[model samples]
Target chain A: LAKTTQPISMDSYEGQEVNITCSHNNIATNDYITWYQQFPSQGPRFIIQGYKTKVTNEVASLFIPADRKSSTLSLPRVSLSDTAVYYCLVVENDMRFGAGTRLTVKP
Target chain B: GAGVSQSPSNKVTEKGKDVELRCDPISGHTALYWYRQSLGQGLEFLIYFQGNSAPDKSGLPSDRFSAERTGGSVSTLTIQRTQQEDSAVYLCASSLTPRGGPSYEQYFGPGTRLTVT
Candidate 1:
């Protein structure tokens, strides 16, 4: 499993774009980058996943660089309800979770 | 469609007692997993079951912790002689599996909060 590092917390205003970066220096060739959103007292929910380049979905977009050493999760036009803890995980077959970045979208 | 479901959302047991937690996965999902999460800690893998084969119990913390999945649809995680450290949120997830193919993304259920006194 690849270890990931991310900020503990980030604050952004409503309607603004937010980007959370995760560093996985030991990422393997077959590993995929996955981001999940977690609210208090609830299990984490999958937001986006990507192996390379950029993958966009209705909820969020995952940007993986050419090196694959890092990836970014971008949320556009955030609202107050979007405030939640974001987890970045790198996995091949088994799953591992990090402390995650707590994104606070304030109005 | 129904999502994953777990029973006994909250449990409070005294020390030296045993407790059982149950999970019912979504329809058509063949892979199930159990994980524990403590306050301020990351999710810790406990065990995994794929179809009717033997489970991967490598992540079980201690001998007192054990889980069983019957008929590949429902699972029960048992904790014998519970201790204070066993108090945490126990989560269950399930994913689709194909022969020789990778397991699909896991769908999680609301966890059961266990408090061992």
Candidate 2:
């Protein structure tokens, strides 16, 4: 399993865009970059996933550089409800998690 | 459609005793997983079951922690001689298939909060 590193926490105001980056220097070829959002007292929900380049969804966007050593999760038009823990995982078969980036969106 | 569901949303047990947590995955899902999350901590993978294959138990913390998936739908995680450290939220997730591709998404249940006193 590849180890992932992300910021401990991030703060953003409403209507702002929040970008969280994760570093996985030892990512494998078969590993895919996936992001999950976890609110307090709830299970993590899938936000977006990508193998390389860019992938966007109704909720967020995932940017994986050519090197694939790092990936970024971009959230547009942030709101207070967007406050949650964002986890970036690089996995193929074994799905492990790291200390996720806690995003606090203020009104 | 109904999402994943877990039983005994909250449980309080005494130390040195045993406890069981149950999970019901989504219908037609062939992959199920168990994870543990301590307060303010990230999820820790416990085990995984894919199709009829042998479960992947490499992530289980100890021999005392065991899980079984019967009929490939319902799963139970059992902890023997539970200690205070065993207190945490047990989460269960299921996906349509195992590593089909980058599109695979794991749907999670609300989880079971266990407190060992």
Taking chain A of candidate 1, what TM-score results? 0.96
What residue pairs clash in candidate 2, if any at all?
none
C-alpha lDDT of all candidate models, in order: 0.88, 0.94
Docking class of 1: acceptable
lDDT of 1 by residue, A1-107 (tens): 57899999999999999999999999988787888888888888889888889999999998999999999999999999999889898875566776889989988
Q: In model 1, which runs have C-alpha deviations exceeding 4 angstroms?
A: B98-103
DockQ of 1: 0.47
> Which 10 consecutive positions of candidate 1 chain B have the poorest summed lDDT?
B97-106
Candidate 2 lDDT score at position B96: 96
lDDT of 2 by residue, B5-110 (tens): 9988999999999999999999999999999999999999999999899999999999999999999899999999999999999999999969537688999999
Interface RMSD of each: 3.5, 1.4
DockQ of each: 0.47, 0.74
Off by over 4 Å in 2: none
TM score of chain A per candidate:
0.96, 0.96
In angstroms, give how far residue B16 of model 2 lies from its true place.
Answer: 1.0
Best by TM-score: 2
